[model samples]
Target: MSKDDDTTQYDGAAGGWGSVRGMLSTFREEADSPAVLRTLMRQNKPGGFMCTSCAWTKPAHPHPFEFCENGAKATLWELTSHRCTPDFFAAHTVGELKGWTDHDLERQGRLTHPMRYDAASDRYLPCSWEDAFEEIGAELAALDPRTAVFYASGHASLETAYLYALFARLYGHNNLPDSSNMCHETTSVALKAVIGAPVGTVAPDDFGQCDAIFFFGQNTGSNSPRFLHTLQECARRGVRIVTFNPVREKGLEVFVNPQHPHEMLTGDGTRISCQYHQVTAGGDIAAMLGLCKHLIAEDDRLRADGRPGVLDHGFIAEHTIGFAEFAAMARNTTWEAIEAASGLARAALLDAAGVYMAAERTIGIYGMGLTQHVHGFENVAGFVNLLLLKGNIGRPGAGISPVRGHSNVQGQRTVGITEKPELAPMDKYRELFGFEPPGETGMNTVDACEGILAGRVKAFVGLGGNFLRAIPEQAAMEQAWTALRLTVQIATKLNRSHLINGRVAFLLPCRGRAEEDVQESGPQTVTMEDSLSRIHGSFSTHEPASPHLLSELAIVAGLAKATLPPNPKVRWDDWTADYAAVRDLIEATYPDQFKDFNKRVFTPGGFHRRNTARDRIWKTGSGKAVFTTPTMLSATSIADAPGRYRLITLRSNDQFNTTIYGYSDRLRGIEGRRNVLLINPRDIERAGLADGQVVALESDAGDGTHREVAGLMVTPFDLPDGCLAGYYPELNPLVPLWLHDIHSKTPASKAVPVRIRS
Candidate 1:
């Protein structure tokens, strides 16, 4: 077998001995022994810190080691002994540091103290906390608040995110764009309009009861390895598991739970997907429509025979709207169009629908594959429409699950890190803080970039994230990023965003999730909400990497205190000292969701915020769930020219979002390399490209500019014909800023029109 088939040919599973070996390799590289081991043990446990990895739900019951291989890497990556100190900065100028790779910068380790950019020497100089705060405050106070963008990353806790929202609102603008804008914004927009709530209805317990679970564009092995354990259990119970993705990812194939004693001892694994359908890039909406159409046709056939209808007619009539129109649209859709758009035959779609019909309950889980497209909003809505047809929502083991990447991207949105102003509770703010938040809509990630480019947006305050590296159009963004008057990053370590400094930039060092945060009240616990909507407290028993590092809560409060003039309504000092004060404000702002903020979160396993849709209660404008119809076959038109290929950007097994851990992707058998493209053998031959041939990918959006990324090697793999896959951020430059979902404004990273060149 070839190197690409290592996962299937060697171990035949994702998380067997390979996971253990990877964890050990990371620990050795980090060079921290018992301390890192202890930290890993406490991950996702009560009174323990949350994993800095992906936001798969934490189990209600306890485990000795709840973290996965990549989760362990994240924790150790934070706890590394290396530190980026004043001396290190003095050695390297800003220009010199800009040339360093992202992995090299992060490997330099934690930021020890606050540093301010010295333009004269082109180096960062350590600055006193008071001076840094006062200067940042002065800059903010001088600029019009409307022009300043306050961005937050998933690394922040609920308490810190709440403070960030309050500070941004009090500072007089709602330019609170966050990490979600680049990721699951499509899900938030679609689900809220369809079901009245932005979050999913299913909980961790639902996995046990689910008779069938369908995955779309989600690579579970790398993004969320812990989820493989849940799938393993379901597969063992004879539950039907189906997958639809452009790439034949090993995660969706088979898995062996590293924690299972029997599997570990015997070196055996469980099969994951019963039916794996390789849909074309930008073809999820078409595949989703095909499934819906198949079910509708089956229902008509069953009814013609005077038997029970295949679709849940009672559920549709009582709890949903626009069923007749939706059914008509599906019935009108032809199988030829579906096959051409989806790159799947009618037989395959019908076979998948048969699995859906056999199960009493089901869940639809998706990831970036479904969202980062031109019609991402429609893609998500289509998924929901299929579940609604089968009445697979609002009951045990049934619902839609958008498996979020970041640890708390969903939590940040819950606590008000959004561009939409109407989502904020204005009346509640008036009753509690005696100040009205900005009523006008603010900018999202893409909008903020455009604003920066146009000189409309001045300063930027980032809670935690490498915003410059995570977004699309990297080259253009790098040029536009210099327009900012000031940039403040509250983070634990160095990232590419730190290198893209403004005229006045400050890097404020903050404690990591694995480090204990001590405030006036004592060692404090931060709360985070999982993708499943369960709010839980995270405590760190490990010592801080640097004594000078402050908690995110303290840093945000200090920034607010310096920027805004003293106000009796907002207690920045008290909230900084005691985090409970922040929680109290959050409860007041969102009483319905967070009534007992302090008590419930601190309790073991935390409490799940009520999802009204889970109880068959739709809070939409029509007071009922609405069925949506897509007017098109797919997000983007199929590639017409022979050499033209649809591009899909993916994260390697060794990386987490923009953070690259190593060059080796063990599952895919790619070692010591990331700048390579995965293509099908047929496509490679048709394009006249040889295996391991160096090539360039160029994209034309019909604008004068032709975006291109060169020096990428071609590696033929299991990708569908007329489709090519490359690593993200590396290929983000090919994605034009204007090419995005119109509703959510999420960059179309998944389905870019491109042609390969030798």
Candidate 2:
């Protein structure tokens, strides 16, 4: 465990006393305030509000302290004592605030009231909620509804997102964009096409039954700490864990279950990953294909032995189609091609294949690493193909697990927040609302930016999220925002997006997950669906962070009322009075699955929602699981330009998405800085660069669009050759708007071709 020049020591294990120390510091600095402590104490507890961190599922039987380090940070962030009132905005001009980093803007704390940009003074001034709504309504009503872009964040509850989508459609537009369009759209695209569902089918309980688990491209420790407990349990039970990623994540190496006091105090933790391999950037597809090839060869060998071969022929024949074509393609694949692309020795893949062959049941866990490439959809297919060959789907202890971001990203999609509205859902809407929904496909995140730059999008409405910060091609996105006639953000706190104004800009403060939302009917509770498809209610016991702030659901209702004319079928007032009314509508729309939605969601641990894939029922044109034959590409195929290195954007251990909790990445041992790029030692030497040397990165965007970020300190680390990693938002510029996956349209953030210079 040697320390790099930047003091980034190779972390042997994740989460010991250091995690406890970070938790305590977060409590003191961010959550020690009166309201914050009261709210934090009740958060993630039974019957309390769900933590607004990553969508890691909660245990059915919760302990007293159910939160983790990042979870606590998210809670403190939402319930922080600091407030940004009118006076704070009045003192700082937009020009001055524009220079501030995203970390500094959010650290100032919760937004207390609605505000509007005062063009005359270049500062934001307090505006009444009523006047703010009226101004937005007037602007939106004046513009062509098709030109209005509606953006959604995963921070909102199912009720809020469902309501927001309904309002946007009722306003006569379906330009709905969401965070998933950037992160997991590829997973959705692949899953829907292959398995007939947009979500995962595996529940947390299945971890206990799994014999082997494959970590395709996920950092479970930092992104999802609670899941590590299950990993530790599997480790104790002698389950095999194989990881395929470009970075040597500490979590995948070893982990200390914080729930276990012995491991926390003694610094002795369960060793998690039995075997770890670093794939080249965008190399997951090749690595997975290599594994599949080895499995096929092993099956052929066992079949010759007159024994039970690894191939589940019975299941494949009865439950799937097109396998013969896939097997032919997989057998034709060469070992040299896979080794060169995956950056792993043939022996390693063969060893991992042996482990897979020995196990009776297995699961493949993946994150953005597998889904943020040009062939991301194909990468997903590769993993699923391996599992399908072994009969993993629709069985206990097996299936695809997409570790999702945002507490309710899955829930929002389930409640019908989508750009591609289908005919069936449209029919349901017409039956309920007495109006026909839009028929054409709408803009996604990247498409919305295209709409903006083309001068087709006039007004932008965001439910919650730092849209301006999260998107790729930041410089272009900012230009697009400036050209828009109107921009409105409904959010809990102030962010840099508010400063990236349009011709007219307004900020509507709303209640966060940790605050109570009192409605006309009574104190209301909202539901959040976890990554496992469990729908559960979350009620905040603490009072609102500020009385001036309204609930997100209420904001959506208010916007609907202010903008849309009354319809006898759609009752905005009734939906706002009681959230249950919204649930009723959702259940009535998706009756087969969401039947008794309100009652089921309130059940202890929340009832698991039905996914057709879980029952081995394929709703596709094939009427069965369809094997996909994808042409495998080189790992660095996207980095085609000469002297170009593939840049993979990442979030530090201290950060979540664009929210900077602090300047440290505990697992990587980085401290007090975000202006550094991680590079392989040999790669740095080849580029004629020394450790700690300042350098610049230039995008391979041959298009007229210029993209680069300079003044970054280079630090040598263990990584795939010709591949570099850096924190996101800083490196997002290198990913041009035009560079994306052709299938899913997701930003190819993981493998943007870039040149490093002195």
Candidate 3:
């Protein structure tokens, strides 16, 4: 590969020398302290801070290096010496800063002081914390509770989330929308309806007990590289691995363990997946229907021959309902529709089904790929249907695992950062805090943006996130953001969202997870819950980025104290001084889930939260796991037209959710740019376009909106003919705010209809 060429073929295994180079380069470029490597060694250990990257679990018997490449990058990125101080803000105006790129804005580094946007000067000037809080309090007090939106991100800890949730409820309404509403809300919605639990059922040790593992829509190498170690161990033990994704991922094919001496010395890696099927975008339901149909048909044949069939008939009869209706729908779905929708032959699905039938125990893992679509709820139900057929639930080595992003995302939701009225304990809140809670449901992410645009929402408060940059309709939302009367952002670093100011905006700097947090209680540790429902304490030994920075706990407490009149039931000062007071409140609210929360969280390896679904006890109205049927084979029904393709928004190996680490996507062999479009070679030839030609993409939503992005370089890759891939936030404009899942309201970022023009 040369500097002129932006794309190249990466033939090496994922997580060998390539990962080593990536980690070292990040450290060399970002680290200010010579002891950064020693700091990295403490990550995920018993008394160390949790890696702030993903929700991947730590092993009971930990290895010397438990962290992954992304974890190292997150640590170094947080601990960088570069500072976005008051001087930097003083030099740049809001209009001038908006012209800069997202990467460059964050590259200016950690925000050191609290700043307020000045309309006259059009620049952010430093302000005292008390004055800033007082102004926000006055603005919020003047507005109706229903008109204010309180948003939270996945980065907040359990203690902070618990306090934040209470703060909003105490003020008035439940307009609490968090990051979970965007990514895995589909999984939570569908799983709760079918299995009576909103979270996954598998534990870490289940990987070793399963005879086979099925992966859907998840990219293990980039999103959660720590999972690659488990996959490598399973592959070495002859566990059959099957994968279904739109793009062929290297992490699922093979992985080289950097920690293993033999592999690092000899450059030998273990072969991972036995079968990989490239399912088309929005085709997961059809593919899953194909698998279910095959297994049911095979069972009928075996039962007629008077032998034991593959279906778990006894389990179905004893513990499930709606089996006949669900099976009928699966059988009614024709193979032709499945083939066209999934872009896979009947033989491929049959082969994967055969692996599932032969195994006594299996685990299914998925990521945002299946959940960020219009019919994402149906896609999740399809996965549960496959697992239910073999009695895979509530058994050893068999369950569903929704690999999540952000360390405490699931934990935040567990502690109650939701918009639904039923999910919150309104009566308990009244009893505990001596206030009557609002009974009406509140706004989600999509609804919040619509509210802001419609002038119904007057204020916005963000705990920690780039809300404008992470959502769809980026240009429209950024423009509409100025309509709000107040905007308060509590953050550690400067992102593009800081530039999109409202009439009165305040940016309050907070402590990062990698920095030590000391309260009146001396030292404090926050808790995080992984994808497996295990709770653990996380603490850092490093100094704060700035001496003026406050903890997230203190910031939330301060805001609550300033906003509302003093109430006898609430003790904001006491809770802020000691986090255990907050934990005691949490345990009292969800007694079964967080019993003895403070004592158990600090112990080695932490504790596992109770999930009744793991014990075959469904918490639904039926008291048993239910089955669901899918009505549609595809998510969208755009008229088939020439040059039409489904555009999938992707994250590079150098990127996290909305944070761009660098310009290079090392795993895909792309360098120095992110404005390149990945298209099939056949599609490029059919469209009469050359490999390196500049092209544009126009979205087709049938809503009379003209959405197009130009100046994209076309690069040929191996994929289905009518599918294209590009990075997110860059491609967010092509998706409309109204295009989302009907049930979950999650923006459909995975599948957008578009046409390519050269």
Candidate 4:
């Protein structure tokens, strides 16, 4: 129980009263009151707004208590009574707050007013919302719209993002970078190339019908606590679960449900993973190929033995293309090559494949672990190849699910928040808004970084996320981002991004998901699309966190009114006041998918958006599932560099993306600090480092130019032999922006080659 000790064993189940204690402690930290208590009770309730945590979908059949431990923590954090007022900023300069930890900055409390950086004062001075909007408008009006970047966070409501996207397009620029560009852009591209859709094929209820589940790369228990409950349910219903990750996370091993009386009282939990394989960092593609190869061999053996074959040849012939070529390519991938690339045994892969062979209905779930690589598309396509082999998709319980990070990251893209602007949306914009939309491909998250550094993108406007901290190579990214003339952030709280100001920086405070967003028309509910492609409505319970705050939709509308040329056709004020009108525009934009969006979104579990891929319809170029046989495993491993190790960034139990809720990582058993790196005992011994040796980790990304983080105390744990792990933002410096996926342009944060300097 020592605050600084890194000796806690990874033995306890994820939940129990530990969850309750954590929840209560977090609530207390938030200055919880009767209002907070009532708001907490309303969370996940029928007809209530959604939790702003992870994107685990709402159940079709609503439960009395549907939220999880982490969800409660997120809610409490957002609803914290403390406010970061204008006086607080006046008391502390931006230069002084620069030294504060990301955790400390967020804990300072909710932002209460609009503020802009004052060069002479060396601080953020309170500014009127209208004045702030006018400043942003003047900047945009002076510059070519293509030179400006408008980024969206994943938590953006569909209504909010629709308006934001409209504003960007109407302003004649598609330089829109979103959080999804960093996380799931590869998931979208790969699925479209292989399975013919960017979304998961399985519904939440499909957990009941799945006979086996393969978890690749993601730590489900910590990242999405509610999803672990789904896994627990699947396990209880006799689903064989196998996980492949570089580290053996506690959540994947054992999970104790706090809601279950027996487990909570007895201090017992359900054993989660039937078999867990510690795949090497940047090795998911090779390992995935290995699994498919073994499956093919097993299918051959079954056919040779005159038993019913494991290969779904009939399904393959009818529903897919390129099987013969893909099968040949898969078999050509030798065990030695796979072992060298993946650091996994041929036998272990065969054993995992055996489970796949036994179960007719299987679901494959993956996360950033697989998608944040140079060959992310290949890694994802490989997973789909494994699923397509058995005709797993288009079935009740069997499919591929890429667990999205944010509550509305998937929804944002569905409603046209994309860098690669589509013609359909352009046509809709022209037809509805009386403006010609831009057709050029715009800057993504990575492109924006390069664009700013190259002096192309002069202005950046962040809709929600901490763009600076979330991206890779923080030092370089900071200089590149802060160099912009105009940087505007529409957010709920003060984060590091706010401190990393530009020449003319403005922080426009916006309402959080937990608070009621009242407009001139009245209290408005926003629409969100969860991970499972279900459209849902979330109505706020607690009043606005600050009287000065505005809804994301209103902010966008205000910006649009200030920036766009006034035309009779564009009803900016009308759309902002009536959010339902925003939804109407969204429905009109995508008529078939968002049909009657307003009526259906307020229902019990909301409405399931139409996924043609789930109905055995292929939307790809081939009009069938296409197999992408990986020609090579290109994700870099630090094996060649003698003193270097493959470093992968992760979120602590208390952290969600760039928002540091606390220093403690309860699930991983670390506390009170974020400066430790988790290395295997074997790696520690090989590096000539002791258990608690203080060291510096330098990136091997750039051409011999050092990018190092010092004072990192090594903590030996159950990580892969040549692997290392550190919490994100701290380790973001070690991840180079150039080291990204070629197709999707996602930063390779999960696989950074770094050397430990003691």
Best by lDDT: 3
Cα lDDT of model 4 by residue, 309-366, tens digit:
7889999999999888888988887899998888889889888888988998999999
TM-score computed on alpha carbons, candidate 1: 0.98
Candidate 2 per-residue C-alpha lDDT over 1-758 given as tens digits, one digit per residue, 9 for 90 to 100: 24855335545578777777777777777665576666666666557778999998877777667777888888888878788888898789999999988888998889998989888899999989889888888888888888998899988888888888888888887788899899999988889998888888798778989999998888887898878877888999999999988898888889887777888778898889899999888887778888888888878888899987888999999989889998888789899988988889999989888888888899889999988888888888888888899889888999889999988888887877788877237888888898978877888999998888788899899988899888888887887678889999988777878998898999999988887888899989899888989888888867677889888888888888888888988888899999999989889888886889887666666778898898899877788887888876452345455588888899887878889888878788777888888888788778889888999898875676668899999887788888888998878878887777778788988888888878
Per-model TM-score versus the true fold: 0.98, 0.98, 0.98, 0.97
Model 1, global lDDT: 0.87
Question: What overall lDDT, based on C-alpha atoms, would model 3 receive against the true structure?
Answer: 0.88
State each model's CA lDDT, in order.
0.87, 0.84, 0.88, 0.85
Model 1 worst lDDT window (10 residues): 1-10
Please provide, for model 3 over 1-758, each residue's C-alpha lDDT reduced to its tens digit, 9 standing for 90 to 100.
22222234467788998898888887777787965676688888777888889889877666899789888888888888889999998899989988887778888878899999999999999999899889998888888989999999899999999989899988888899888888999988989999999999998889999999999999999999999999998988989999999988878888889999899888798899999999998889999999999999999899999999999999888878878999998888889999998889999999999999999999999988899999999888889999999999998899999999888999988988889979987777988999888888999999999998888999999999889988988777888899999999999888888888889999999999888899998788898898899998888878888998999999999999999999988999999888888889999999989999988876666688988888899987798888888888886546457767888898988877788878878777778888989987778778898878899998888788888888899887767768899998888889888888888988888888888878
Count clashing residue pairs per candidate.
0, 0, 0, 2
* Structural RMSD, model 2: 1.6
Candidate 2 Cα deviation (angstroms), residue 199: 1.0
Pairs clashing within candidate 1: none
> Which portions of model 2 miss their true places by more than 4 Å?
1-7, 635-642
State the lDDT at 576 in candidate 4.
83
lDDT of 1 at 441: 93
